[model samples]
Target: MAYLRQVVKTQSIDIALINETHCGPRDTSTATDVKTILDAGEAVLTAGDWKAKDPHWNATKTSPRGTQLLHDADALAFEVIGPDVPTHYPDQTAWVPDTIDLVVYRGFPGRIALDVLVDEFLSDHQMVVAELSDSTPSTTPTQPRRTIDWSVFQTTLDAAPSLPTPSNAQEIDDTAVKLTSLIQNALTAATTTENPKIIEDRLPGRLMKLIAEKRTLRRQWQASRCPRQKADLNCLALKVRRALEDHAKTSWETTVDDATTDWVRLHRLCRSLNGPLKHHDGSYIYSASSRAELFADHLETQFQPNPAKDPMRARRIETAAEDLMRQRIPAEEDPIYISPSAVFRAARLQRAPGPDGIPNLALRHLSKRMLASNGRVPRHGKGLRQSLARRVTRESEDSGTTTEA
Candidate 1:
């Protein structure tokens, strides 16, 4: 009782229950033992600082078995939440179990989602577990992962309508929206209905079931000591071992396939296997958005310029920019005339998709049609095009090379 009291106090348990306690035959003696375990004084009981309940405490109607509940008096309203099922078995070979134990809670009855007896058969008494919830269940459903076919994505993208030429800023905005929607729709259409084995390292369901059945059969054979049962258990054990070996081989092959076929999945699998990174305070950075925020904050703080610290250098840079703008420039040179090969190289260099979830390769194939109409710049972007042309001409002259219009 003293050890139990110390454990309760050390663990800060608000409620505790003891079953089949043979404290004493008399109510007065049992109450005295309860007081010692609860660490409650006469003054504390009078002030309602602690409360206890024992249904079989009377000396007149004495019984060997007794259950008691002790809790903080000021805590939430508690009572005996009962599943009314058998919890105790007499022996390992006993066919029937008896209900000689109960579970007690220190919170509202509504907080308990379930209370049940588990047939573990490890000991004479069955295990009792409760599921408690103070909040409502989440409404969002988990989305199953699916493989996307790149060929289908390309086909769908090619079938989409050609982008309209924009003459103004609103038309430019409208065109961007259309392209974004088209890309997203094509990606959706390309997604396969099949959800592959994402966690390849996990044991397959059939293998797990076989393993469990083998355990049960081994136990039964040990109890019965029958030669036929022993033979059956041995065969099951062999099957389980074979299933495990097959699963291991299949999992390794699947991991290799995923690493070669999908770079995104490979990256995710590597991160998962390596575990998550931690913040400065030793908390895990679990979500991608949180990690992005952390990186953004770090870069913002580390790279912020202190222009006042180097005033002379800042002035020299500004003067150089002004001088470069004042130099002589050609009238008709196209500054942003990017070659197809250069575009392809730039797109290929981007190994990961952008924040908008569009593949960088899409830009290489779609840029020419979207950026210009019939090989000419859109009307709204002509001013910027001329500005760039002047800049290029000035730079070309500075390099002692003439830019022909």
Candidate 2:
């Protein structure tokens, strides 16, 4: 039994069949020993004794312990034959083959059989044979081809040219028009809408008015103060400028308080001034100080000092400024020239001047500026020369006259 289990392990067959042990039917000692061998080998066990009747053979439950043996040779034979057995073999009776008790059991697909019967009458002992069937279906179908309408296909081909091609100019124009309308409508809606709840109900508009008054006071203080105080005033002015720019760009629903907080800082600065600042045009400065002082303070803070103030720093600033200006201003001559016809068409379609001596046309304004500067605007000399030559040739032909060059 140990040798049979070793053979099953080494050979790798699915089921192990043991036959002709020559053991007593009543004792079950050989079956117990075989089961112990099978348990150690991790294989299922089924057994039969040729001497035993009725039950034939039965497979034991697979487990770590040895399988329980049974005396049932007939039952084991029925399991071996499965459902494909005929009622009788040749002229033999149903129970004629009593000596040939079969026992069959299944295991993992790779276990080898221990011993098997080969039919000595046919060849040697009874042999176990396995046959495999290729149950796959055929790929090709046994059918004829279906007809398609050639006229329908031809009609589709003929209709292809009539389909609309995409137009980029039309799409761009539509997008531009839509964007313009949307912006205009949004602006109009913003103007018409009431103030949001937070701004409208909370401060009673007094906080915003106070902030504006404070900013005015600060501007006045900055204008009146001496050169030392100018830097602080300038910083305040910059903050104000940024705030105003932000306010301008903001949506209408933005709160007045949120928009005007920078103004409050300017107001605090103005309150520090000695007196109200007066303007050159006789208007009072934002605070109590003369207009000249205010203007001087503004210049001191905003404008960089001349080279005389600090020669090296001034020179560096001047060079940087020159480079910046050069970059900002376009070249006098465009690298890509415009066609004369396009320019002429643009000039011709320009609007006329208004009643207030204001030239509504861009070309007329440019021409006026050019004339005032004593600059010569380009004219089509070639066209004029061509027209003159044509006129001379027409006159000479009509009069039948010729001149030698």
Candidate 3:
């Protein structure tokens, strides 16, 4: 059992099968022992698809074992997959080769593309090889982040045509589109696309070598079935398990320390470590879209205003703000204007690109004439949306300033 865990960890096996378990009617000792190992192993290893209280596991716990027919259905929703050929080969003591090996999986049926028996002569039983393919669909498509070279980006932008100044609302829209496109093109020319780095195993050479030795011992014990060989294998398995535990602890500590200052990184790391997300009903969230929807729903619920609180008070405050804006506005349309200095200051700030995808760096390096023109206020209800204009008007009224607007 310990050697089984070693194989799963070293090989990064997502699913495993154990054959020749020697569990049958009137004797479930071996099966019970395996379950015990699994109970403990899951803590240090990855969790299994089946739960402890699964109907199949509970029903078969102490029941007399019967031969599992090919058409037998699994109560726990696991599908049994078997090769068309025999897998077990008895030594000279028996002439017939029997099919005792089977694979049980609970996932998308199309995931496993092939299930074949391989004659490797490693043991009496031929190895069962299952090939899996990633055919599941994802909701959101991810784009690789472009790694921009600031110096190259600056040079590219400098070599491009001068930004055009806009005089009206239509021109403003066109100019924004053109500016965003130019920045995007410059970013493409001066950048390389690379996906985020994933963490890999960094186990020490000594530990890796020990794992290899353990594998060799496991194979030897399986072949010989000698008490001495078993003892040696057991001793080595204990050592390997302890070493793996220590290495895991150290790795976790290091990861936490490095991620301390970056909450986003820390959050991602924790999610990866915690296994798959489950729905409120206990089923696993498989599709990326499903997980995303679940999160969105949860956030929506959290941000919703409390029904128990005063709803009238909120409406009154909003009404007061709207009334004040109406009272302060002049009969004639006088638009708000952002000074050139203010625009320059805003463009100089280090921030992410807006919804238009225009980065601050692009705005900062744009021509002074274009910047001044862009800062000029458009006629009321022309350049900005009504809601945005109202917000700005109310803010200006509160500040006792109308020239800025």
Candidate 4:
């Protein structure tokens, strides 16, 4: 079992098949022990005269100290992959052959290629070889990121034709599209020449080849009589292990940085991570188009002119403000101006675009223009569907001013 653990760790084996596991009876191991050493988010199967629980070899004599293998296997949800069969090799000396060898499974038999391996080395025992199914559907691994060449990007950007300052919105849109296309093309070209994740994330070719021969390397190191030879191989193993660890650490950091907590964040992080977007009415919006439409509909409702709320109170307030303005300037108080400062303070940084498809970035850059154009006082039943104008009234304890903001 100790040697088996060493193989699993060094070789990264997901599933294993062993004869005479003897997991049952007089043993006092926990579920955590089995799970930690072998199970990788999967089940494990055991059988025969010895398993995690005491084996019930119906034909053979029973031992006083039995195992809870039957109870444990049930608890772990492991299925008896194959029916009981004669696994122990033929014993010519015995009048009747005994069936003592066993085959244990972890997951379903679906992708597993099972076979009986008979050998004389174990005397009566035979090896049960099982090739478990590949967990990944594709043999190839997909990379969300790649090493980008800044030189290529810079060259591509420099080669792109500079557009004149956009005199109109259409020209601005066209320029944005062209720049986006150029940048995307450059990235695609740069990536094409680079090694993929499988190759890029691997150890150096020589080191990787050496790591692959770990079984032979281990055997040679163990048998070698020369201390110097053993030391040299040990040093090589350490270097290879260090390299692998560094690569794994880098990969984990990247994954963590790019991970998402919610569906919205996940979708924003990667377009491939689409999920249902629920509507305000308690239904789900599935498709991207549907989600966008629902969002736009909500924004349209907000953009629609809101009916006057507390009209009578507004009139009273307006009258009071007019009276205060007419009275005069107070000698001690400073009047505050109705400005865009409130809205600016309210704007959140790095926010996702609203239904209008405009991120805070574009709005912030054009904020001054938007604010400067605020002088056009909103007229009842006016030009645009709704107005951006907000009325602000600032006053001191002794003085007041009314401003249409």
Cα lDDT computed for each candidate against the true fold: 0.55, 0.40, 0.57, 0.50
In angstroms, give how far residue 299 of model 2 lies from its true place: 90
Instruction: Estimate the TM-score of every prediction.
Output: 0.35, 0.18, 0.38, 0.23
User: Could you tell me the lDDT of residue 405 within candidate 2?
Assistant: 28
- Indicate the TM-score of model 2: 0.18
- The root-mean-square deviation over C-alpha atoms between each candidate and the true structure, in angstroms, is 17.7, 46.6, 17.7, 22.9
Deviation in Å, model 3, residue 45 alpha carbon:
23
- Model 4, position 55, has a per-residue lDDT of 34
Against the true structure, whose lDDT is highest? 3
Model 1 over residues 53-171: C-alpha lDDT tens digits? 23321112112333333232223233443334555444345344444343433333234433444332334444555444433322222356767777777678777778777766567
Candidate 3 C-alpha lDDT tens digits along 44-90: 12222111111232222221232232123343333544455555554
Better lDDT candidate (2, 3): 3
lDDT of 2 by residue, 209-327 (tens): 54444344444554465664455545654555555555445533354445456787556444444344444443445444555677887899899753487788778988999999889
Give me the overall lDDT of model 4. Answer: 0.50
The pairs that clash in candidate 4 are: 24-51, 45-105, 53-68, 53-69, 54-67, 54-68, 54-69
